[model samples]
Target: MTVRTGDELPPLRIPITRTLIVAGALASRDYQDVHHDAEAAKEKGSPDIFMNILTTNGLVGRYITDHFGPRARLRKVAIRLGAPNYPGDEMVLTGQVTAVAEGTVEVAVTGRNGIGHHVTGKVTAELPTDGPGTGDAPGTGDAPGTGDAPGTGDGPGTGDARKRTTDSPATTDAPMTTPDTPR
Candidate 1:
C-alpha cells in the first residue's frame, strides 16, 4: 500500500542525469556553469558536470512523497553529495523506512552514481491514514494535501542544501578526481 504522511516507506530509487542536473540548477537559480558547461566543468576539475546536492535531495523526496500523491507532507530532508555524475553514469537514489511519528515518517536515503554516491540523507514527511482524519498536519500550516508547509517545514525546511557532487571525478578518464569504483 502507498505510505501516507507519517508512514514509513519500504524504499525508493531514482536515476540521475545531465538533464536532471541542468534542470535542477536552472530551477534553483544556481547558475554555475560548472554544473552545465563541460569545458568549465573540466576546468573546475570535473567530467561533464553534475547535479547540485540540493536538487538531489529534493528529487529524492519527490521520488518517495510523489508515490503517495498530494497527501504526503515533507517534514525534513538532509543529504551529502559524493561523486560527480557524468552523462553516462546512472545514479541510483534509494532509501528505507527509518521511523514514523506524529503524522510524520522518516526515511534514511542515499543516491550513488555509477562511480559512487552523490547523496546520502534523511527525510521526514506527513502521511495521512485512510481513516477519518482532521487532514491537518502538525507543522503544515495550510493543511494536509496542500503544497503549503507550516512551522518546521515553512521555515528553514523549504529548500534543500547543495554542493558539487565531488571535489574530483571518480571514474576512468574522470579528467579531474580519482576513481571510486566499488571495491
Candidate 2:
C-alpha cells in the first residue's frame, strides 16, 4: 500500500468491560492481582482492577495492524501506560503515520479513556508492497496473549517481551528503539 507520513488511521473505540480486563490479564498470564482482583487492587491502592501493560501493548499492535491490514508485520512496539483502564470506561485508539520508508511504516499511537490517556506509544511495521489484505486474514497470525512469539507477556511478573516469529525464537537482546534508530 502507498502510505505517507501524516496519514491518520481511523479511530477505534473499545469498551472497557470487567470481563475484558480479567480476560486480558488471564490470557497474558499476568497474575498481577491489580489486573483481575478488584479487592486486591483496592488493597494495593488502586480503586479497582486495571488493565495491564501487556494487554495495552497488544491493543496498540492491533490498532496498527487493523489499519495497515494483516500483511503488516509488527517490527517494534514501544508503549507507556498513563491512566488506568477500569471497567465502565471506553478507550479510543488513534494513530498517525509518523514516517514511511521503503516497505515499512511507523505510527505514533494513543489510547484515551475517560480518565485520560491510557496508553501512548509508537509502532513500526513492515507492510507488504503488494497492498493491504494481501496476506493471511487478520487473527490467523500470531495473536496477542497467546503463547506466541511476539506477545509473550513481558509485563510485570511475566517473561520476555522481545519480538519473534512463530517459527523461531527471538535473536536480539538490544533494547526496543524508535524508528529513528538504525536497525
Candidate 3:
C-alpha cells in the first residue's frame, strides 16, 4: 500500500434502501423514528425515513477500510451530512489521499447521492509501513480465520447494512511522500 497525496480511491456505490436505513438504525441501537418509521419521518416534515448519522459513519469507515485493507485503523473521521438519503437513491463514495506520513494517511472523502452531497469528511488512518501484502506476515496476529474470527468474508458487508458494489480499477498509486518526510 504505497499511498501518496492526490491518489484517488475507487468509488463504492451504496444503495439506500429502506431495509438498510432501518437495519442500520436498529443495529446501532438508534431508535430514532426518523431513521426507521416513514410515517414518523413524514410527521417530522421529512419526505421519508432517512439514514442516521451513525449508519453513514459506519459506511464511511467501511469505505476507507475496504480500500485500505482490513489492517487499516481509522484514527479520526470528521464528517457532516448534507442530503438526506432516501430509500430509492444511492450514494457513491469517493476519496482522494491528501497526506501520507510514516505510517499514516489522510483522505478527503465525499458521498454523493441524487440530492447532492450526502456526506463529506476527512479520515485519518494508520497503515502498516511494511507495505502491501504484509498484513498477514508473521507476528502480525491478524491473519484471517485465526481464533473465532468468523471465517473469511465474502467481500464487504454481510448480514448487516446493504451489500455495496465497488467499481474500482487497480487504483493504488505510487508513493510520492517519503516516510518521516514533510509533505
Candidate 4:
C-alpha cells in the first residue's frame, strides 16, 4: 500500500512471556540479569524480569519496516522507554505517518503494555521510489534534465523493470536447521 501522511499503520499485538523476554534479550546481546532472571529482577525492585532497551528498539524497528515493506530502509529511530514490559503482559504497537517527503517517510510510533506506554519513538525511513506501492511513476519524481523515464531502462527510476522469480532452490528445500534444533 502506498503510504501517506496521517496514515495509520496496522497494529501489532505481541504477548509478553518469560521465553519472549529472555529470547529478545539474548537476541539483542543484552545479558542484564533483570531481563532474564526474575529473582534478580525482584532484587532490583522490579516485580519480575523486564525487557531490555535493545529489544524495545528492535521491536520498534520491526514495526516500522513491517509496515513499509522490505524496500524501506530505516534512516533513524529514536525511542524512549516508559513503563516496563513484564512477562504475561501484551504489547500493542501502533504508528502513524507524520510526513511523506520525496523519498522518505517519517513515522511516530508507540508500543504500549497494560500498564502504560512501553516505548515511544519516531522513525525516518527511506523508501524505494520505483518499487511497487510507492506511487511514484518513472520520470515523475526525477530531477529535470535527467532523461529518466519508465520503460526506457535509462536510470534507476523504472518500476517493474526487472524480472522477479520465486523458483529458487531454497524455496524447494527443507528449512535450514538452527543451533536450537536437536540433531
| Best candidate (score: lDDT) | 3
List per-prediction Cα lDDT, in the order shown: 0.58, 0.74, 0.76, 0.72
Model 1: per-residue Cα lDDT over 1-183, one tens digit each: 333223344445455677878888898889999878889998887767877766776788776665534455565666777787667677766666655444445667777777877778877665554443223324333344443344444333445312212222222211111111122
lDDT of 2 by residue, 34-131 (tens): 98888999998999999999888888988887777654678778788999999999999999987776556778999999999999988877665442
| Residue 124 lDDT in candidate 2 | 79
Ranking by lDDT: 3, 2, 4, 1
TM-score, prediction 3: 0.75
RMSD of each: 14.1, 9.2, 9.7, 16.3
User: Residue 139 CA error for candidate 3 (Å)?
Assistant: 16
Candidate 1 error regions (>4 Å): 1-15, 130-183
Error of 1 at 71 (Å): 1.6
Candidate 4: worst 10 consecutive residues by lDDT?
A: 165-174
Q: Give the Å shift of residue 122 in candidate 1.
A: 0.6
TM-score of each: 0.64, 0.73, 0.75, 0.71
Q: For candidate 3, lDDT tens digit of each residue in 1-183?
A: 457889899999999999999999999999999998889999999999999999999999999888876666666789999999999999999999987765677899999999999999988776655433334233445455543145345322343113322222133345733222344
Write the residue-wise lDDT of candidate 4 on 1-183 in tens digits: 455678889899989999989999999888999999989999989999998988888888888767665445566788999999999999999999777765567789999999999999888776665523332233333343333333455334453323321112121112222222345
The predicted structure with the larger lDDT, 1 or 2, is 2
Backbone clashes (count) for model 2: 0
Model 3, runs deviating above 4 Å: 131-183
